[model samples]
Target: MTSILLDTPNVPALKVENLVVDFKTKNGVVNAVRGVSFSVDRGEVLAVVGESGSGKTITSLTTMALLPSTARTAGVVEVDGHDVLNASEADMDSKRGNVVSMVFQEPMTALNPSMKVGKQVAEAILNHRGLSKAEAMARAVELLDRVGIPDPAVKARNFPHQLSGGQRQRVVIAIALACDPTLIIADEPTTALDVTVQAEILELLRNLVKETNTALLLITHNMGVVADLSDRVVVMNAGKVIETGTTVQVLTEPAEPYTQALLAAVPTLPEAQWDAIFAEERTGEPRHAEPAGNSPLVDPVLDMREVCVDYTSGGRKLRAVNQAGLVINRGEIVGLVGESGSGKSTLGRAPLGLVPVTGGEITLFGGNVLKASTREIRKLRSRIGIIFQDPGGSLDPRMTVGDSIAEPLVMHGVNGKRPGRAERDARVRELLEAVRLPAANANRYPHELSGGQRQRIGLARALALAPELLIADEPTSALDVSVQDEVLTLLLDLQKEHGFGCLFISHDLAVVHSVSQRVTVMQHGNVIESGLSSKVLQRPEAPYTRHLLASVPSPNPIVQRQRREARTALLLSSGTRGS
Candidate 1:
């Protein structure tokens, strides 16, 4: 019997044959997944890449039988050689954490906020392994440590809210690994993370696949991530599989047009191309944009000197920005690049006086922000337009998009006077046309619009006044690559037309490279590096800047592997953990 058992071939970790999923909506039956077929073997990584609503997520969720009640599923889902689709709820409940588990996109949402993180991991272990509370808790701590959570025994006692975003994600990974599941499905696990943190999570997932021989199903829109870890690639579009091949074949020599388009949409840093860009951007205009010649002496649109911003957290004074200096020339876009808590956003907000800086000078339109009175500051703010990261949150849900776009005009008035309704309406329509949104969409609510559409509304609202300076804070971070490209192109076009100097705040280097004439690197509340995009980006001076650049995964598998080899050593030696 032992010889027979040893001789038996290993069953695939997960297999889905001709899967179909449809959601019963008020409009109609929406097909989420149509005849999707794939399998993940032990110690192998399968990546599902596609844009939003491409059924990549739906197919992964079906394996664990976690779809909503309004959805209908059909197909064979086998986990550990056992049928999952036809299994009883009781059987699925028993098998879920034991045979398969999932890591969610948002770690905070995945974890129980009220419970201690360690207990959360222990609970998963206790449910499947039938271990005592103490044993499960002990194992949970061990698992956390294995996943690189420092001082796991102590951290396990802390609530989820106490940990950083990356730490919270690590905790989530620990829960998934607690039961020694044969397969782990990570759905956009690193989507909301910084490049450095994303690199760490990818490393953790890759190590687990190798050390524990676990099958990994990674579903993401990030092609860079696909090249970094996936062994085989599956490209999905409109609920169907458009392409499939090894990672190298799919990324480098994509056979399908859709796959090719998807790969092309990804932003890349071409080092050689950046070398030719203008190095002294303060004196010259952007290559694509002409000088507006607004000021007599051509004063900077926005300038910061020794700017300091502080926030009180947990009874301790925290410096969010420190002595940050930057200058945005007229018709120029200066990119502020940094990880979370690196003070990019804080510094961006300083010009608007939204976050009061504790010290330093902010010159807006050549006026000092530090010495300006509240009335003066308010007046100066009229020349500044702001775009937030979350388009939905930024827009008022109670009003139509038209009303939202005209809100700044309502508050500040048009042409230094209280504008009539007709004027506001015409301006609203003009702005709608400018953003490429139909005038009819003015009647739509924020919730009714798609993510990309809503962001366009944000643009219309920000540019309603056509301010001299614009603050675009991570405007394209939440969008798909294709949509991101569209939004960016439109933003640049508008910037050129309006001749507004822009502070483009984002963590993405490739995006900054494409858009900004100059770039600044931030870390731990300090301005680590700053220069022209040509010099700072291609030939970074600071070690941290190079690390940040290296942390970004390449879409090419071979190049990413080479980058990984060098970056792994740097990260290990420096012990850098992203905020």
Candidate 2:
């Protein structure tokens, strides 16, 4: 690409004009992006926010010329006055990493697993700048250090699998910064990371942009990330931009209906606003009423006391859950909140005896779970349900939706006996309808449905046996904001109707606060704090709990900026960085 120097100094670092992208599929033509226009100036962060299939990623990929050959595009994509759309093959190749770079969503998938992270970053530098191997490697270490990776020299020799998620992402950012590109496109950079790690990554990106005066194009579904970093915002839906304005204007005072819906769907920690919105959506109806007759003799659906779970890896014992105790009464929703690897999932599995308990006791309906007989365990399985984090992976790919939902019923012999084919089929249809999916979807495969639809299918299958207790482990983490809202609402509605207790495990504090009556905070396999959601989240006692709450980014830019500043100050005072 031949660079065109603009006469005026006011030219944006990156610009797109009337961009349109279409994909020709066997079914029909799909319009991915339609006449979308945006610009990012030097030292500016521009965010494109949208739900899944809203064309945010498509627009970014087209801008970087990274889309597959099947994608047809008509747009003016320019970086530093170099027209990216019309650039020659060689020019595009040269400009890809030299003038522009992209940090993908999943660093594990983006980084070369076979190679050491340092070597991969060094390769980028060598390919673009023609530097010596030794020099490039040294620069790689420096870049890693710049991105806040501890012991950069030692970490450079480690393969991608050896590093944590946040470290791997830092390596990806290092590679992107290796060439000193004027424009950087970070696509969902922190979506898969824990909140504390997310804060650090966002801080690093913001600092890098400020230090280098580089333009940043951030594509994400996370409104919090947009509020925390972006200076301007572009809201997209159904392959079109519905709103565009300053971050404050768009987040606080969205003019479009789609934008309003998207913002309203985002889960927030403050209960009053969320409850008010939920009440309004339900036509001023309360979410749940108090139980009748204040009974004194009620057994908890799930109860754990001094539970401990351990595993031996490489002859070393790893404690996953230590003295974790909690209680969930019938029809109550209790949230388990923590960062990744904080033993939340392990504790969630204790009720069903999925994880062996080394100490303490777990009781389900007043029956000992740890020492249950085979027959008793089999019986327990029918009354307990689990919703995994990834519905795409958890759902059986080879089975039809009907068979998948009916599998549990087939195994458990619902209603004390094995049901016939007709009964099974009817139960499956009933479940699909209960989850708000059409009965016709029973014949469709999981791959044919969207992420939200697949999650609903998972929920339907989990509830196929009419379980008394549900373990929802990060059920909506991978979904879009609106879809997450839908799933959470459905879960609440179902819990109310069936009066089943729920153990909601998630790292999202806001989401946990919205659906859960009580909250338990865990860190490093230990229960740090436990109390009512309103009290624990609003007036957290433990330092770790306070840190977790503070790390969450708000949708309001001004408030989020203050939170970021306060988090940085706290970290500095503690003489440590992100956990």
Could you say which candidate leads in TM-score?
Answer: 2
Clash pairs detected, candidate 2: 1-91
Per model, state how many residue pairs clash: 0, 1
**Candidate 2 lDDT over residue span 1-579, tens digit each:** 234453346778788899999999999999999999989898899999999889999988876788888888897988878888877788788888778899999998999899999999999899888779999999999999999889999999999999999999999999999988888999999999999889889989999999988889999999999999999999999899889999999999999999999999999876223233323334634234222311112559887889999999999999999998888889888999999999999999877777878999888888898889989988988998889999999988999999999999888987799999999999998998899999999999999999999999999999988889999999999999999999999999999999998899999999999999888889999987887787777655565775687689999888787677656655654567644
Model 1 residue-pair collision total: 0
State, as a TM-score between 0 and 1, how close model 2 is to the true structure.
Answer: 0.93
* Model 2 residue 365 lDDT score: 83
Off by over 4 Å in 1: 1-10, 271-298, 313-315, 572-579
Clashing pairs in 1: none
RMSD of each: 5.2, 6.0
